[model samples]
Target: TDLNWPEEPIYKEYREAIKAKYQIDRLMKKRPNSRISIFAKIQAAEENLAQSQAGENNSDFDEEIPF
Candidate 1:
């Protein structure tokens, strides 16, 4: 099916409100003192460390902005 699209941005507030509601729903579902396995914690830590190291390595390279 062919679709007609808006040339300018639209439904900005509706989109943001939907995102906010999703975040609120996610936060409400999270339990305090949730149990996580030690191995899972280690894996998460390793992933975070890897991401930070990757970012640090990329810091030497400059990124170009379209604007």
Candidate 2:
């Protein structure tokens, strides 16, 4: 339990390699991966969609060609 596992899956490879290199030959398969839930991902996507929609509707900026 002294190992500091990463919260992201991308870091899992590095973590596993490090564990293998330093661990006392213990299996890492039983270890749990920390990550965000699917609901969180969905909520973030929804928020992004709303922001994009709002930006599209509020396009009061100049459309002039800066050639």
lDDT of each: 0.67, 0.67
Clashes found in each candidate (C-alpha, N, C closer than 3 A): 0, 0
- How does candidate 1 score on lDDT? 0.67
Model 2 lDDT at residue 59: 90
Strongest candidate by lDDT: 1
TM-score of each model, paired residue for residue = 0.36, 0.36
Kindly give the stretch of ten consecutive residues in candidate 1 with the minimal lDDT sum: 1-10
TM-score of 2: 0.36
**Residue-level lDDT tens digits of model 1 in 1-67:** 1135456765778566665866865765664434456667989999999999999788854455444
* Candidate 2, 7-67: lDDT as tens digits: 7664667766776787834544334322345667888999999999899778955565465
Off by over 4 Å in 1: 1-36, 61-67
- What's model 2's lDDT at 21? 82
